[model samples]
Target: MGGSFKTQREVNGLFELTDSARNNLKNNAYYNDDLAPTKLDERTWGTYHIAALWVGMSVCIPTYMMASGLMAQGLSWWQAILNIALGNLIVLIPMQLNSHAGTKYGIPYPVFARLSFGIKGAHIASIARAIVAAGWFGIQTWIGGGAINAALSIVSPAWGAWSAGIWVSFFAFWALNVWIAHKGPDAIKFMESWGAPILGVLSLSLMIWAVTAVTQMGGSVGDILNLPATYAPGGFWKIFLPGLTANIAFWATLALNIPDFSRYAKTQKDQFMGQLLGLPTTMAAFAFVGVFVTGATSIVYGEFLWDPVAVVANIGSPIAGLLGALGIAVATLTTNIAANVVAPANGISNLNPQKITYGMGAIITGVFGVVMMPWKLMETAGAYLFDWLGTYGLFLGPLAGMYVADYYIFRKKTLDLDDLFKGEESRYWYKNGINDKAIWTWVIAGIFPVLGKMVPALSFFSDNGWLIGFVVAMIVYPVLMKNDTSSLITPEEEEAMNEKVTG
Candidate 1:
């Protein structure tokens, strides 16, 4: 039973629960300090902060590898950059749509899902996001560790020569990431606000270095850049369609869980304008840098060096090596904490908000990251792009569609903030805290992508899994939701509930 609040307050379309309401909700199993809505004063992230967040997350090793990965699949340098731009542009629509709910309601992704997926059933979205985030957390940690190991190796010959040094660095870096994440969202915001500028400078410096090195080696950066496609196994569309899907899938997870960051945003315009200015442009620009640098690598080393850490390590000056190593470390750290840590920490905390604190959830996420053995996941460019990304995009894309449809079409962009925290007493608490309509809709939409992955005949569906899943869920969720009023509250009902809580 929810208690009456002493007063009502709304800021920039975000509802802030009064002290009375907060106290009443505090004892509920589903309610926890970490999972609660942000207060009016806490919503301080403006356009620059949100934009900087994207810049920090986008300029990572994975973003750096995106062009090289596509090139490995037989795309020319320009083709890869264009594909990355288009995919990011396509994904930005859903990213912004999902972000609306976060800014408007001041809720994280799991709590936002409660409107459509029900209370307990929201786990479907949260856990799915958590699984994907864990893998990414591991991959970034591994890359950061390699950078740290490289820097340490320069200082101490014995540490560099020791067979176990790399493992030592890996675990040490992993612990540091978990520790910093446990410090909470403010720590993350501080890192991103400060780290974005430094990363931008380092990325540009690397690109310039590549061009100068290639020229001095008496090889043409222009010639390497002009090189045509080397290995399109089936043809252009065969490589392209999947490459586009993989690129979209790269950030598809963020599309669903963006609220984790956007909840801190000050206004809808702040989040929207910030995301528009940040995500696509930074990704496209980074892809170009990656492609150009890799091209220069071919001229300087006579072999394609896809890994940026390896490229930085190859530079002879010990001081330059240290700086490059630190740059990679910082880039990986900023990305991992913002992109990988937040989703799972918040999602897993949704599981038992009473017992699992956000910091605890973050530590648990780190353990899961290690257990996933991300080294295996990064074995090859082909496996990373096609196998891992394509497979996950199959399910996540539909999730974005469902979240959009429920928020925009079915609910008309309205949510009762107080009821969202209730247990069996709430309208969102359908059928033992699960929405059968949403679960069934997700399964039905996901089946096609799953089949496509399994059956070679339906490989087109798998290749374009994210778009397929998104469209199917968009079409299906609305129809199912039309007749199912289980989660819907009429105007009268909403007014009454608001009065009850406020009185």
Candidate 2:
């Protein structure tokens, strides 16, 4: 009993709630042990665990694709690595700022969103996040399915020659992914911790293989260091700015939903050290592997290869090809479950807490994955690079800016947690369970970056979408809330709260 906080017994007959916080909220779709604010006793993750989570996620096909995809577009090996480093380093600032709210308050990102976006307005942002995660799930599934089919073909080439085998493999891999995601957060945590060391060892082995293969082909190692760019059709700033935007956006999903994991941190130091060690270093190291391996493939096979699955498929030796492809499949499995499924599941659950559980949310994502047919988006260079990554940066950019500005600037890093779950008459329920100001702020900031992408002449806007959107929200949000913090608790409310706690 943290004051006379209202928990709805019923909201427009949506579901029965009660002043009894435990009995009312626990089984409701909105209330889960996973989604609830973490009590002190629940914070258990250490720096090592956090670091491993990053490594497991980083040593995957997307990280490989992120680097290779950039090089395939026009970046030098060094340029691609540099951008990855810089994008990740810059993104780390917002990620850390967002993580602090979670680590201190023990709330997941959706709950965190309530402060910035209003109680129900947060759902709008939450669903946007879920959409991105679902799209990624499908893309990663296609990759894993392709790899599995390759391995199966090595075992039985004639069967692999048929399209039926690929379809079968795709369905099989999808089912596996759904199973892991459905098992819930604990399974994801276990996979990240247990799978990281294995994947890291595999990454080193792949690098060693690439270097040895290139050497045998009489390819100078120096060739990779100085490969000429094939497609820099635009000026450097034009190319670099847009390319850098894509890089920042690559992990932007995690930037928003990191609270899903960081809330489990045993200490802020652990989360900081773990992310500090994990993100840039692992991304840089993995990008290096991607650049080297793709370059080595060009020398050996006389064609640039972007997809690691495609590279492994043509390895020629049945044993090496099958094992390498299987390794990639496993890596994708770890990444899809950890990176794609968790955020969206939590987000979808946040939308209708009485109806959707994490398991149901995960299944909904799988259905969307099937409907989206994400393989088409990955079929070409432009589709993979700009269409997916650049476009997502448009909307997500505003989100990043809004969350950072709201927490750091407006509220001054302070929040009222008990009011967060209160159904009605809560200060957060500004207008009909939504904050029109926050909704409009997101819309205004979101429009510019998205417009940049649509208008062919304003490519510069697209190039700098996330950066601009973020800056706009940071500046605009403070102005909107400056004279109107009726939403915030006044000194009198704090005194009353204190009396309730003390008395």
Candidate 3:
């Protein structure tokens, strides 16, 4: 009887172990098994590297285009800036919360997802994220190709030849990014360290040139700043709220996966400092520079222009155009590797935790990127692609809400960290490695928001669908899963789970 009790306890603990615990026990075979876990030298990534990533990611053509959109929406530059800052602040909250877990556990995002979604069901979330990443990868590559092509046009008016050359350059760089990603996390770390700073220097140089040109052309800074708003206000709720929600959702993809990077931090302090330095200070500064340069461009050209590539092309200097294209290409590659590659890698790894390694995940994601034909979608759909992706927030919002509610409200910050890894017949093995109640609540909560985004009549709430999904999940997941404590492992069981993880 005693032996049977001990065996049962062990089995229960295994079933309850969280995904990270499982990875630790399984020697991280699910992802990057060939690469031994290297205790991240946290000091290697200082505030500067963290800051640079935000700079590189945020201070680009897309950001400038988005800022232009805000300006077009009739918001004063100051108002637009304020709105973006607030939206980014909202994004930072979840990122910080998720990062805490990552810094503590040193696990990637997919592994972490298992804690909330179940080892098996986690794949659904992972695949969704991967799809998004793959799509962006192709889109960005295509955009970068266009920029390169534009620059080439100045050098040689032979349009077709230059276009072909531009695509070739884009693919070459794209292939290089893939190779770097395959070299594993270290390559990413190195790129993040250098890419942002280089891009910053280039951006600042452009800004300086623009400002100098404006001054030389007898335009005052005040004149430059007072550019007229282009967009008419539909209503406060329609305009302001939509902009706010779009800004938040714009960051949802990265915000959701912050833990993947944060887990490498040596300590929670490192994570906190990184976020503080990275998001508000670095990202805001980049945006400010973007606006400033863009404003100068408008002053010089007698029209509001948002795309940096367009701004450079309008500079009427072939050299400047070429340099601008080069900078954008480099920045795109950096973001593509860091954000796009990792998100999918985590997703694929989660799908078959025992079979897919990190390298395998990257290859799979890359293949998906090819199949998705992201470039064609971007060309056809344009900005609507971004708006369409807002529906994903319905699913992600609920997932995030449930995770947060489970950790803070229901579980009271306590976690079993064991049963997450166990096989069938284990407590968390609810109907074959899934929590149906959680799933049902998630699907239910996600539907209305998606409907709001999709259906014209229901569009009033379209902008705030993410928030709706979040609120619904927060309310429903706990209520539905209540007293179903079998899905969770106990603290004593966590010890046994830890032994397996550390073994």
lDDT of each: 0.85, 0.79, 0.64
lDDT per residue (tens digit) for residues 65-130 in model 3: 555556554556766677678878887777777666555544566656666666676677678778
Estimate the lDDT of model 2: 0.79
Candidate 1: which pairs clash?
A: none
Q: So what's the TM-score on candidate 2?
A: 0.92
Clashes of 1: 0
Off by more than 4 A, model 2: 1-30, 232-235, 495-503
For model 2, residues 310-373, the per-residue Cα lDDT tens digits are 8888886889888888888887888889989988888888887877788999999998887778
Report lDDT (Cα) of residue 385, candidate 1: 86
lDDT, candidate 1, at 340: 93
> Poorest 10 consecutive residues of model 3 by lDDT?
1-10
Clashes of each: 0, 4, 12
Error of 3 at 246 (Å): 1.9
RMSD of each: 2.4, 4.8, 4.8
Which 10 consecutive residues of model 1 have the lowest summed lDDT?
494-503
Q: Report residue 183 deviation for candidate 1 (angstroms).
A: 1.4
In model 3, state the lDDT of residue 104: 54
